[model samples]
Every structure is written in C-alpha cells, then in structure tokens.
Target: MNVSDIKWEYIFNIELAIENFGYVLSGIGYTLLISAVGFALGLIWGFILSLMRISQLTLLNKFAAIYISFMRGTPTLVLLFLLYFGFPFIGVYFDAVPAAILGFTLSSAAYIAEIIRSALNAINHGQWEAGMSLGLPRQKVLWRIIVPQALRIAVPPLSNVILDLVKSSSLAAMITVPDIFQNAKIVGGRENDYMTMYIMVALIYWGICSGYEVLQRKLEKQFGSY
Candidate 1:
C-alpha cells in the first residue's frame, strides 16, 4: 500500500502556498511584535518577581510564590481566554493584540521568575561577602557582583524562554489576533488547502526559532567569557 494504492489522491497545492505566501508572511511582523514586547515586559516583571521570591520579607516571598504557582499551574490558553473574553464580565475589556500581549507577558513571567530565582540563588554567597568586604554597599554589591554573575549563568535559560515565547505566540491565533498562525489559518480555510498553509506556518515558526537558538549560542559564548 503506497502512493499509487491510495484510492484518492493526497495533494499539497503548491499554487495555494505560493499565492498566499505574502499573506502568511505578513503576520510575521505581528508575531515578532508580540513576542518581543511581551518578553521585554515579562523579563522586567520577572526580575521583580525573582527579587520578591528571594526577599527576606515573608509577605513578599509568599505573594511571589503563590503568583508563580498559580500562573504555572494554569494553561496559557485559559489565561488568554480570561483576558480576552472573561474580563468583559468584570467591566474590563482589551483588544485582540493587547490581550494577547498581556497574556503572554503574564504567562512567560512565571517561568522566567523561576529561572531568574534559580540563577540568582546559584551565585556563591562568598561573592556577596567579598563585595561587602571590599567596602561596597549592599545595593552596590548586589547590582555589581551578584546580578552580573547570575545574569551570566542565566543567559542560556533566559534564551530558552525567548524561544518558547516566540513559538507560543502562535497561540494568539486562537483569539483572532491575526498573527502568523491566524493568517495561515485564514488562508487555509479560504483556499481549502489547510495542509499547505499549516506546513508553511510550521516552517516559518521553525525558521524564526532556529535563528533564536543561534543567537543563544553566541550569547552563551559572550557570557561564558567573563
């Protein structure tokens, strides 16, 4: 039972892929925009969460712990649904793009918070002592000595988060955000060529993520040097 043995022909319409090539590719901009902006905001929020997680104050630590646990336990899609759909019931409403951005930011920050916490915790306590012994203030010691080392250790995992965000940005399609996957889905439906459209979208996502992985390697080299 091979290709010839099949009763009906399985055709991948290259014409449809070629015709809608630009249509699908156009969504790349929105996809990148969402990922870049979300990741940037999430990183900042995550850093704050990381600090809170490691804070000596019990309230801050507990709050950060519960937040991270809740975000991690729930599905990202549910968060998106709550933001885009459920929020309207409470008198909150967000447009598609904003909702998608906020959803990713909130979800990614949870994972990033843990990554940052682990990295920060990995730094040697002696490094902190050494900085203080050199007459540095606690703030200065943390910023100059502790954070730099931790960031170096964190580059790889943080890079992984970025890649994850890029791929996960496809989820924006579910809410009619018209990102790459959404546009592809549109073309697939209109043309009745779902296979080609989906395959093209998958390749595009692969290409984008492959570039991030390459950048990750370069970042590892740069951070590893010092």
Candidate 2:
C-alpha cells in the first residue's frame, strides 16, 4: 500500500469490521465503565480521605497521608498488575477489568483526596466562622456551604484529571482489555491499514476530550459565578 497507490476509495471492510466491532466496542465500553466506576469510587473515597486529612485526629490524618503517598508513588499499570496477579495469592482473584477499575480507582482516590483538600483549604476561614455564628452545625456548614464553593473552584483541575483518566485507559490494551487502541491494533493488523486505524482512534479520543472541555466550560460559566 504505497502512499500514492493506496486507494482512498478502498472500502472499509464493514462486514469484517462489524464482526470484530463488538470486541472493539466492548473494549470501549470497558474503558468507560472503568473510568466511571473508578472516578465515582474515587470521589467518595477521596472525600472521606480529604475529611480525614483535615480532621484533628492524628491517627486518621496519618492513615490518609500514607494512603495518598502509596498510591501516588506507584504507576497505575503497576498497581493494576499487582491487583490482578498478586491478589490471587491472598484469595482475591479479580479479573482484568475489575482489577483495572480497582487499581485506577485507588490511584484516582489518592489524587482526588489531595485535590479536595486543597479546595477545602482555599475556602476562607471567615466562611466557617460566619456559618458557626449563624448557629449552623459543623456538618451542615460543610455540606451546605463550604463543599459547594470548593467544588466550583476544583472543577478545572478535576476536569483535567478526568481527561487524564480517559487517556490512561489506553493502557488497558496492554492487558488485552480490548479498548480503542487495542481495537485499532487488531483492525490495522487485519487490513494492514495501521495509519488509518490509528488516526481514527486518535480522532475518537480527541472528540471525546473536546466534548469534555466544552462541558467543562459550560460548568465553569454556570457555577463559577459563586
């Protein structure tokens, strides 16, 4: 397939691609599922960790510090491999997808915790004092006032983290998880159209990330006024 000789009109093998498309689509579905579950879990875990970091209890703060340190120090792929391969010795036999989710979620939780802590710190001390003066409970003040403001300030970086998560999902292909890159590799091997397949995959990823940016901008505009 010389550059000039390669036919642009060369029809994409839709039938063959369709037959294999399910695997590809399944890979993408797995990618999205892992990201969604991982991020959601991270949010909850991170919130708790953030609270712990800010708590007056020395033991809880130490635990949060250690968890964030461990996860942040390790690469996500290494973490995934550890969970998938090492856990079986301890009787926790997670399949590839579950392992990926678990690892990513753990890693994400660490970063998210730090992000939330920073956001929490960014809130003014006056806000807390004012809330307390109004006779609002500590939990109520955090839930009803502080958290909302912190989240708005946190959205930009948080959105960036999500974008990284989406891209990081490509690593799942290494474990034969059938994500977009894996799909492109398989198709390119069959058709010998490596460039086209890769280009298409890049476009797809770009499309998703671009859409996220648009949504992020809308969110910033809508909520940033606070």
lDDT of 2 by residue, 1-226 (tens): 6889866544454455555555555567776777778888888999999999999999999999999999999999888878887889999888778877888889999999999999999999999999999999999999999999999988898888778888888877766677888888988888776666666677677877888899899999988776
lDDT of 1 by residue, 1-226 (tens): 6978854322456777788989899999989999999999999999999999999999999999999999999998999999999999999999999999999999889999999999999998999899999999999998989998898888888998899899999988898888889999888788777888888888899999999899889888888897
TM-score of each: 0.96, 0.86
Q: Any runs in candidate 2 off by more than 4 Å, and if so which? A: 1-26
What's the true lDDT of residue 73 in model 2?
95
Best by TM-score: 1
Off by over 4 Å in 1: 6-11
Instruction: Supply every candidate's count of residue pairs whose N, Cα or C atoms clash at under 3 angstroms.
Output: 0, 0
